[model samples]
Target: MTLLAGRRVLLVEDESLVAMLAEDMLLDLGCEVVVAMRLDKALAQARTGSFDLAVLDVNLGDTRSYPVADLLFERGTPFLFATGYGRQGLEEAYKAVPVLQKPYQAAPLKHLLTRLLMGEPPTREGTGGGPMPCGCHISREQQPFQVDHCS
Candidate 1:
């Protein structure tokens, strides 16, 4: 439906190439994306953009993305993170948000984001919760969902 087709999003990443690919994938998923390559920029956009969701990198160029996450949380915006170092390496506070490991394709990203955006709780893969294939980026350090796609 067109309602899902034009969902607005805010994307935060420091890498230019990754930013471009992720923007494309979000567009394919029907999101009109706004990008911020730094934490400040992302926070600015997160505060100002007409965003329905966010796809944020866990670490920005020089700062952790927790502040940005806090802003998104305040607005009740759902998000999926794109992390290169995997959930195993993050602080306890950040383990709850869904993650798309680096080198992911579009399909899984869509599945995860859709579930979160639709107000579906992301139960950690082992708790017999939301979606099946057990990609647990929720409530704990997930085992890292890897799809092996370059983009």
Candidate 2:
């Protein structure tokens, strides 16, 4: 059974190729994905879009997506940050949020999403920690998924 079946996901990414790949992965997980390439569009959708969860790129071009994140936070939405800089890239206020390093694999992404959506603690194999804030920050960067743009 797919973990995210019937779940709607808002994917905020600036790079088209990365978005395409992530969308494919999300579809494979049985998730309905809404792609937003720019921060403004993502913000609009974040405020009004009906989605179960969101995956936001930390940086979008010259601007950051913190505003969108703030809106999502206000709405009590669950989200994960996809960034090339890992947890270090995020500001102190956002350190506790789940982070997925760039170039991620399908399996880890799936595991993380499952945990996030199911409200479970992130416990994968040897990794040990108390329940993560929402998701775990996996640092390894995969080769195929590179961050071309911030948003």
Candidate 3:
């Protein structure tokens, strides 16, 4: 019923709980999700699987997910980075790739996914088309469920 219905999405996140939550969101959006909790597994999936889009965590424990991003780039796959660090977290080469600032919200996630599916090139501008500094900003209580701007 949504633009993402029946779409295949590769979700790469190091944290288990975050990954689970994001998987749930994707499932709710009617997407077939493949999750990679480590850089190696993510790289393998990027090499072998076909995906409509991918959401990659910038930090994967001891490593960064840029290699996976590179592979996806080579494949011409449309993917976005999910990080608390906004566009500043991305390397200079990948600044233009869309970013889903953590913690992920269903609405923004849905919006970005729809944009990618529609073949829209994500700009370096903030998720809402406004500029923001860092992407991560939880409430004073530090609730992990809080949704930050996805730039």
Candidate 4:
């Protein structure tokens, strides 16, 4: 919570309900979250300032977030991808960045986000997009999570 207290975050998700819920979660965690429903809007915002980090969906409205990820990478802004598509859905280059799967409980998500912001490498296969390396929270009893909320 304290990790993101004053950090600036850009949230990019096409689905309205999921976007709103994520926004609420960011607020609950005390991070300043900006909502961007599309790639263009989020890119425009990215041009304005150096955001501390970002939470993006792998796919937007007919567009992919990989380009945005490149932009964020160039700017040294660390980001996590929130995708309903699960791990196999991820592109090769981005399999290394952190992933936070859909339907996460607030506390686990918060912990993951905090660790991410602090620059910790992941230890377990994230239910969505993280490389199992640095000791992260992975669900032992479950297969990967899938979120079709947007579908």
Candidate 5:
């Protein structure tokens, strides 16, 4: 069985290509994906959306997505930060949250999501003695409307 089966995920990313890649990966993992490409839309969804977990981009254009993160935290929802600048890009308040650096591959992404949503540790073999990489940060692309889907 897939690791993330039946889990719902809220993916907040400003970059279109990155969002699409994430969506595809999440689908492959058997999780439902809800996408928001801007801070306002993401915040609205964060306030009202039902999700098992969230993947938050540290920055949404010129604005930070911390408000959304705060909302998710208040809702008791688990989340992680996706940043191009790595953990250094996050504010001190969120330092303990997991961070997925840019240019990551599928294995680490799946591993992290599985760990977060399922409370399972990533396999130790070949994990490089640290947090696994997950495809998060990528170059920007044209904006797309919000979407929610599962495979």
Candidate 6:
């Protein structure tokens, strides 16, 4: 079985099609998936749900999913952003989080989640508390989020 087998994952995406596609990918990876299509619903889940990981959409139509990210952060839950804009879309406060560039493919998604679930340090690319490609710096005081492993 894959590392993702039997894991519980929270997937927050505003678009129905994208959600379905991601859910299918996760299911194929043998994960138990929980889906949230709105900010409020995602918040509620993030606040109380027991999940091994979460994939959050940076944009949720009229709102952003940063609040959900904050909640997950406080809980020490590992999550990554899924966006078409790549890392460029993230705000300064969240630049360190791993991002899954959109048009989500099954292969890269599996690779990232597997690496994360295995307790490997997230590949931060150029955002390792250094200046981004855009010449913006991420604060060292902002601790990187950790992924909790399932027993």
What shift in Å separates residue 72 of candidate 6 from its native position after superposition? 0.7
Off by over 4 Å in 1: 120-151
Query: What is candidate 5's lDDT per residue for 1-151, written digit by digit as tens?
Result: 8757888999999999989998888788888999999999999999888988888888899999999888876787877778778777777666656777765456656656665665422222243223433333322332121111100
After TM-score superposition, the amount by which residue 97's alpha carbon in candidate 1 deviates from its true location, in angstroms, is 1.0
Output the number of the lDDT-best candidate: 3
Show pairs that collide, candidate 6: none
Leading candidate by TM-score:
3
Which sections of candidate 5 miss by over 4 Å?
120-151
Off by over 4 Å in 2: 120-151
Give a tens-digit lDDT track for model 6, residues 1-151: 9889999999999999999999999999999999999999999999989988999999999999999988886776777788888777888777767777787778667766775665533323353443212111323344242212111
Stronger candidate by lDDT (4 vs 5): 5
**Candidate RMSDs in order:** 6.7, 7.2, 6.4, 6.1, 10.3, 9.3
User: What C-alpha lDDT, on a 0 to 100 scale, does residue 117 get in candidate 2?
Assistant: 76
Off by over 4 Å in 6: 120-151
Error of 3 at 125 (Å): 14
Residue pairs with colliding backbones in model 4 are: 122-134, 123-133, 123-134, 123-135
lDDT of 1 by residue, 53-102 (tens): 78888878668888888787667787777887777756666566677787
The residue-by-residue lDDT of candidate 3 on 1-151, one tens digit each, is 8779999999999999999999999999999999999999999999999998999999998899999988987787888889998877877767767778898899778866776766544433343333223233334365434323332
- Residue 19 of model 6, lDDT score: 98
Model 1's C-alpha root-mean-square deviation from the true structure amounts to 6.7
Q: Alpha carbon lDDT of residue 76, candidate 3?
A: 74
